[model samples]
Target: MTLLLLLAAAALQPAVEPQPSLAAKELRRIPAEEARQGATAGHGSVYAIGNHEIGRYDAKTGQRVARWDGDPAQFPHLNSCELDGRDLVCAASNYPNVPMSSQILWFDATTLKLRRTHSLGHGHGSLTWVTRHAGAWYACYANYDGKGGEPGRDHRETTVVRLDDRLNETALWTFPDSVLERFSPRSASGGAWGDDGLLYVTGHDRPEMYVMRVPAKGSVLEHVTTIALPTDGQAIGWEQGQNRVLWSIERKRTEMVASRVPPVK
Candidate 1:
């Protein structure tokens, strides 16, 4: 009787596919080995890339498009990515697999084809992603001292790179120690920008997020505020409209939360 019941339950649910949501939701969920973090737009379209492959999706329309291997050589580990004009810029790194090394890869926005890959050098580090501001593209990364970002993985600083419209790095800005201290307790995690002209980053240490003003006419950024978050907060970003809306993603539970970041009175 128990066996029969188990069989009945199994029959009710569809057989698990390589990526269930990609097929069910009409949005390609890149292979886990290839993608870890993703970004979406207002029209139900999302860009999923990381690890070694890249995919595009339209959740509502159920269109899942993928490029077999975005960058196979850099595969198995891309921490984060973002859309730049008509390109997908990713921060490729060896997290637990390989320590202290990562690179940036550029792909054509339409076909999801590889355009160029830049070696960013070695350091126990992971980049948050890239975004456009003042007609320039930028990406941020956390640098650690030890392996797999172990507890001993002392962070020296966070970096921001200026890229061309084609997604190539042209200039770099390394936040100084004073600016890094505001994030006193380092938690090398996700980050995003706010319409308030602030950059928001998350922490693994506790249920909290921090906001800092993008330095004006300077290289070092300044911390402005810290917001409380749920325990499982894994990634964060801000979407600007009437006001800057802040979003937090709890990956494990597949949940997300949004809040507003308003102007200073």
Candidate 2:
């Protein structure tokens, strides 16, 4: 009789609603030989980022304007970049190497020349992506579970760190367990803050981007939803003036793709 009563009560409870699935509409694909790692857009141009190379192409004509190649030993792994004002701010790291170190590189947006570099030494995993938002800098530090991971830290250690103008850590937050599960064996390879006040991140090779929000008072970011992307994840950047547009890369095809992301409800 007690079992029957419990079952009746359980059936009366409300059902859990499944998370919504969203898709990005692919707008265009431009051939960018340097689109090996990630891509960003600004100043009527799209920049294709490689480990040690960057190719600037006219967005309208799809013509390569200029390219910059760096010494691999010096600028080993430039994971991602975003155009900031007149400079292209990039996040670089020494990955697949222990005691992971990272740095921030600033380059001339128009000239595609190395302007300056800020070494982050070795601390919060490997800096994979960084962007300026709401008067502060948000950076994603990647911690792998296998190849590039340290002895102790693994994928769970991947974090989003907020820093001041001088690049000093202000606060930090980890990903939720659900999101971490998707990043297992690897980590977040790209991230950016959306105008809707949500944070979007991508795993090493997943074709999905996870949307999250910083909890009111917690160390773990709250998972909002996942959006399907047309390309495998690496690094990404929001379109400069477009409300819901983003630029990403298709590594296998060596192309830079532009997509219009749907707004989160």
Candidate 3:
């Protein structure tokens, strides 16, 4: 009876299919000094990031508000962050060394203080970015042939994994080879779920973001579109309010920038 019920439930699920591409327009750039890794927006504030540091800023005025320094031995590389309710959840990894490991760092949204740490012991590359969608947590576990990733796995093996609220992976999807090829030696650096319900990913040092959706029949995610941005990619965030904007950081200048779909005429 249980088997019959399981099969019946599965039959009612919708089959996933490829989605069409769409373009995002560039709006403006915000000059900043703490955006070495990535940026995100929340609660009238913006968070600019470095590998081991994070700073809070006024979302409208771009003024520095607060900053937090992470321990090098524990939180060496903080690739990106997402605003979850009253908490800022960030992805951190140990890079430029063997046996790569990663963790999730949670911070208080108002105080910008480290609140908790959850380790995702060594497996499936380095955790680059994390976000929550439809009650599940999605994390990008990136790989590379370069200095810091898994030694044997090719850079093409990077994956995005969906985890339950407890951080246990439930489903996984890989990027299309065409997308992976664009990264060359490095792997995916940032990811976020757009307001349109598609997963947007950015490659290392590239000013492009790839749109992807999970396919029903395979482990590979379907490629939707490639949207251009102003700066080389690191991490990204999607602002879902009336602004409908996308945010990123220019690592070289430590600048945070924002872009949005052009307003309809």
Candidate 4:
């Protein structure tokens, strides 16, 4: 009778679905002094992002073309950047400081000059990455466990917010448990919506990108798959005009690396 009951319980349990994995192929590396935070590609140029500086390099020649330096007091931590039309939209924050605050900085892609700033005053963790998808803006607010964390919240509180054209929050969602486990102490540092209609995000220092989708029934994002990358994560950007090419940074080497990411099945 005991054996029969155990067998019945096992039959009632759901079968575990295998998690799919994909590998990104490294394409090329470009040395950029400002590649400490992240990199973005657009308009025949690749921009290397630093805390308060940005260097634009020729994507084909790998030669430095233009550079922009901002006041560190105003722009302390520039986490990541993405190319949107004629501008390079960047995520900035006052990290490792109490009461985290974030802002969105836009620079002219041609001149590499600061064009505008929109302050997203303290509330939803440090803004790590932001991008536009399907006419809506998606932003990642990262909450760390130790250094840059707040009083009550930790990494588990990291969130993704959707905003309208004017940047008003419309909806919000959190990461899945499995993906959150990968970001235990440090939170997600980069995120972008892929052309394939999936969201790809990277953790603080992992050489992996989690492919996710907004769940139809919950406030948590669904983990669809994982992709292995060549560079340890800080911030990532998808190359403009390229199908599935991603641009990331090698912080230690101060280099910008490009990888061809495979499509999820």
Candidate 5:
């Protein structure tokens, strides 16, 4: 697929190692922030999707691979998107990725052809990335309390929806009120699962990082913690100078920042 990657200012904020998985030893990243909604990675490619459009970049060289996307079928909105195994997953939402009426589209990575479409019933939120954890797939959608425009992403509630055989929200895990109260009623944005099996979620606008263990049961999810995030969208990326792994932070006007996860040793 043809890609158009545009590079900009590069900066690496001091990094701090978190856990066994989010440790700076595991990831590599470059500084290219877009009000970055979501990130998708595969082979030698990485996708960073936002409200403007989608971009494909060389994960190794940090070069623009391509840009492909359009308007939402219903509203003029496209939330976040991710890559499943060998396919490209995208979500278009007027209300965070919800709506029994709206759908999430899966396209072929090589051909970019529309393969399958799944619908999330009403009450769903702005869909971000489709995460695969514990041999099962989950769709990450954020419910926002903001009004509109890019700034709206900052005020949202993240919804972790469990898909049934029919791609329905059989069981869902949402942020507890205590965790939500830590930050403003912000929107939950990009999230990713590490090789360590821990699920790291970011508040669209909240200044804290929410990490949750793929709980054995829904009720156990209350253990989710809120760590300070330098910025929004603290998902995953390579720390520029240190060349490590980290939960990348969302940038305001530019792209997201690939802050170091820890001090370079």
Candidate 6:
């Protein structure tokens, strides 16, 4: 196979982790109020997370209650997260590395404790965002070329996949040309299932979210609409309560922003 083809083939293999060198740590403290990449609210608490750490806060008082720090070399690159029942499911990847690999990291919603790590054999793209919807799981596999060691990747190479409950791939969908243009070199950053039955997603740095839905008979998702967001980051969350607002973290500000999304027509 050609060099580019070889890389593409390697991307389909299972993710590999470095040898365990140090033990992961736990702390009952707060993370730096900035650098937050994702957020989720559940179990009477709110989680603010960065690529390096995760913090739990009281839902009402917003007071930091617990924290967990990942080994820098082990649990790096946590992008976005969503509350799956009592667990916080996060989409993580090894960026700046060639043949990007990814993992689905899970945490206990009440304690912010790491519970499980599901390696998503690097196939779809570079799993940037993942969420469960309608009895199935949906994931965004992102690709970055030129700057991120993926020189073979063009703007149109990214994709989203539907998986069974066991996380086995079932189908795949490519973003529309217009949405792919917004991603450019980077694929979708954040994704969540909206209350309106649409899959909402954000680009790496764009301050807008794209709404998409699986088509009845096609490999490409149907572009529904776009909504401006207050902040941008690598992942997004949707509040599950009656308010039903959207949540995102501003990595630069290290802060979380929430907004209400109008139901699609």
Return whichever of 5 and 6 wins on lDDT: 6
Query: Quick one: best lDDT, which candidate?
Result: 4
Q: Give per-residue CA lDDT, model 5, range 44-149, as digits (tens).
A: 6666665646666776787776765555454345555556667776765665332323457777765555677766644445565566556566776655455432
How do the residues 1-265 of candidate 2 rate in per-residue lDDT, one tens digit apiece?
A: 9999999999999876344399999999999999999999988999999999999999999999999999999888999999899999999998878799999999999999999999999998999999888999999999987898999999999999999999999999999988898888899988888999898898888888999999999899999999999999989999798878899999999999999999999
TM-score of each: 0.62, 0.92, 0.88, 0.92, 0.67, 0.84
Q: Write the per-residue lDDT of candidate 1 for residues 56-171, one digit (tens) a residue.
A: 65434435655546445556466555555666666666665445567777777667787888776664356655566777776776655454554544565567777786656777
Model 3 ranges off by over 4 Å: 1-23, 262-265
- Candidate 6 regions off by >4 Å? 1-35
Count clashes in each candidate, considering only residues at least 3 apart in sequence or on different chains: 6, 0, 0, 0, 35, 2
Order by TM-score, highest first: 4, 2, 3, 6, 5, 1
User: Tens digit of lDDT per residue, candidate 3, span 6-118?
Assistant: 99999999866323244466766666677888988867888888889888888878788898987888778899999998999999988766688888999998788999999
The parts of candidate 1 lying over 4 Å away from their true place are: 1-35, 59-73, 97-99, 123-125, 149-153, 161-186, 204-207, 216-219, 229-248, 254-265
Residue pairs in candidate 1 whose N, alpha carbon or C atoms collide under 3 angstroms:
26-62, 51-77, 51-78, 52-75, 100-123, 100-124
RMSD of 1: 14.2
Q: Which lDDT tens digits does candidate 6 get at residues 1-265?
A: 5999999999999767222122212112223373367776666666787876887777667678888788868866777778888888888878756677889988887777899998886675677888898899988888775565365676588888889988988898898987887777677888888777889888887777788888999899888777766665457777678355666766776766666666666
Measured with C-alpha atoms, the lDDT of residue 182 in candidate 2 is 81
- How displaced is residue 235 in candidate 4, in Å? 0.6
Local distance difference test, candidate 2: 0.92
- Report per-prediction Cα RMSD to one decimal: 14.2, 4.4, 11.4, 4.3, 13.0, 12.7
TM-score of 6: 0.84
Which prediction has more favorable lDDT, 4 or 5?
4
Superposed by TM-score, candidate 3 places the C-alpha of residue 230 at a distance from the truth, in angstroms, of 0.9
